[model samples]
Target: MDARKVEKITALLISAMIVCLSFSGEWDWQTVGIYAGSNMPERLLYPFFHTNMFHALLNSWCLLSIIFIYDIGIGRLLSAYMIAVTVPVDTLGYFTTMDSPTVGLSGLVFALFGSISFEVLRKRYYQLWMLFYLVAGFLFPGINAVLHLWCYVLGLIMALLNKPVKIMHHER
Candidate 1:
């Protein structure tokens, strides 16, 4: 199978999974998202769910865009995705005492943004745009700006520690 084909399939499957999960429940993030009293499973699982269809679609779009734009292989993308999901759950989720629980894939989206920024697009303008977006994110109600920042920093560190390897297609 061609590597590009596999990458596209993987991204599509992931995006579909996220959207499907969002539809599986009528409960909002407040009901299932990670809160201070949330169990371990909730912490780990909350990133996969979203509050609504619009949120799900936006996240899915970002996820697909990042994967396609950066040409990230499944292994690398999965690694960063896991890190984005788990690190915050175990770290900040342990210490934060917010009234609301955290949910959605924005953290992973920002992580991918950070990874692409550091490894592939080092342009100052791109980074400035991300910075502006990050700042603007704080102004929106119900946004987890802290989680986004943490994931972005984590993504940057992951890029520094292990740079992304572009996948090459070979037909046999």
Candidate 2:
């Protein structure tokens, strides 16, 4: 499948997949997201699934925004990246002081932000400084820094490795 098609449907498909999860009474991140106790299959579901409506919507919005603004380069890579993006984050979360189930699309969203920064800004200090403003959430309790950082790093890697499609500015 093409990456463009995947990008277009990603938000809807993932959002729909978790709607029934909300009604399934298994909304706990422990059951649906990645944690130390999570099996391999559950870990596979971590990046794409959400435990609540708000979380799902927030991620869907992020995904949609990236689809519209970013080139996404290759659609198939988007699918692979979406799934692989969470691995290191989850692994770090599981190993590094995450005593409870940590769940949210924030990591994935952050990854998108990171990829956009790396691919578009390309180490331009002026633009990269904007990333500092995103620090507020990092200080919040129950938020794992390792997971977010790792996801971001992976996103950067993918964006750089996959031939970044830097959307050129075209003034109307």
- What lDDT would each prediction earn against the true structure? 0.77, 0.62
**What does the lDDT come to for candidate 2?**
0.62
Candidate 1 TM-score, true structure as reference: 0.81
Kindly give the stretch of ten consecutive residues in candidate 1 with the minimal lDDT sum.
Answer: 88-97
TM-score of each: 0.81, 0.68
Candidate 2, superposed: residue stretches over 4 Å from native: 1-6, 23-28, 73-96, 118-130, 163-172
- Write model 1 residue lDDT over 1-172, tens digit each, in one string: 9987898888899789989988887776656687656676776778788888899999999988877777788777777678655754446755444567787888878887777776554579888888998888777877877788888888777777776577999999
lDDT, candidate 1, equals 0.77
lDDT of 2 by residue, 67-135 (tens): 677765444335445744446544575446757666666676666666665556457772455356345
The lowest-lDDT stretch of 10 consecutive residues in candidate 2 is 76-85
Q: After superposition, how far is residue 84 of candidate 2 from its true place, in Å?
A: 4.6
